[model samples]
Target: MGVLSNLKPTESELEILQILWEKGDCTVRDVHEILGKNKDAGYTTTLKLMQIMHEKGLVTRDTSSKTHIYKALINQQKTEQQLVTKMIDNVFNGSAARLVMQALGNHTASKEEIDSIKKYLDELGNK
Candidate 1:
């Protein structure tokens, strides 16, 4: 757990973080454009959400130039782990096996993905 271990991003904030994590660093316009493709979002709403995220320590804004650049301060992997851990605890009664079983039962795992999962399980078994 790092500084952001306890910080849980809201759905809207997570959307912005996804853009930042994928694009590295971006201006509000950059994120807004990409977000516009998926949902009906207003520019000011995105800007305001990003500003709040900065205050929450989820992102950092550099105001050196005319347009401010924003970068994700939270680690993507850590955030995913945190969310998944919470899900396992709350939704699956702390049973990771149940979660995995439900996921595999409901969704299709590609052959490659199955192979990777098998490999990971093998590694875990070794440990």
Candidate 2:
């Protein structure tokens, strides 16, 4: 709902952004190593994906040092909001109530989580 409302990075780019967000700034090697821990991506693949992300302005690189450090240019919350908005529009036919119903029905909600959601809804009503 903020800036970059139309920006939607690919799944791989999002994965890299997650790493950058968690690790702050990282080199290709650092990303590759972390990615390799879960999947079978080659170092070159990681490097090429990062290069594309940089070109797309999804990330920024500092080349002052020998190894370039890449950081996510987009904020995580903004990106998440953009993605969720798109999902609601496309998958729920712009029906937020339908989306919320499907989510709550499909997943098990703990009492604490349900209470939290109720509190948030109450706050929205106050607003």
Instruction: Count clashes in each candidate, considering only residues at least 3 apart in sequence or on different chains.
Output: 0, 0
Candidate 2, 1-127: lDDT as tens digits: 6556555688999999999999999999999999999999999999999999889899999999999999999998878878888999999999988989999999999999999999999999999
What are the per-residue Cα lDDT tens digits for candidate 1 across 37-119? 99999999999999999999999999999999999998899888888988999999999999999999999999999999999
The most accurate candidate by lDDT is: 1
Q: Which ten residues in a row have the lowest lDDT in candidate 1?
A: 1-10
> Per-residue error at 119 for model 1, in Å?
0.6
Local distance difference test, candidate 2: 0.92
Residue pairs in steric clash, candidate 1?
none
Local lDDT at 79 for model 2: 85
* TM-score, candidate number 1: 0.93
Model 2: CA > 4 A from native: 1-7, 109-111
What pairs collide in candidate 2? Answer: none
How do all models score by TM-score?
0.93, 0.86
TM-score of 2: 0.86
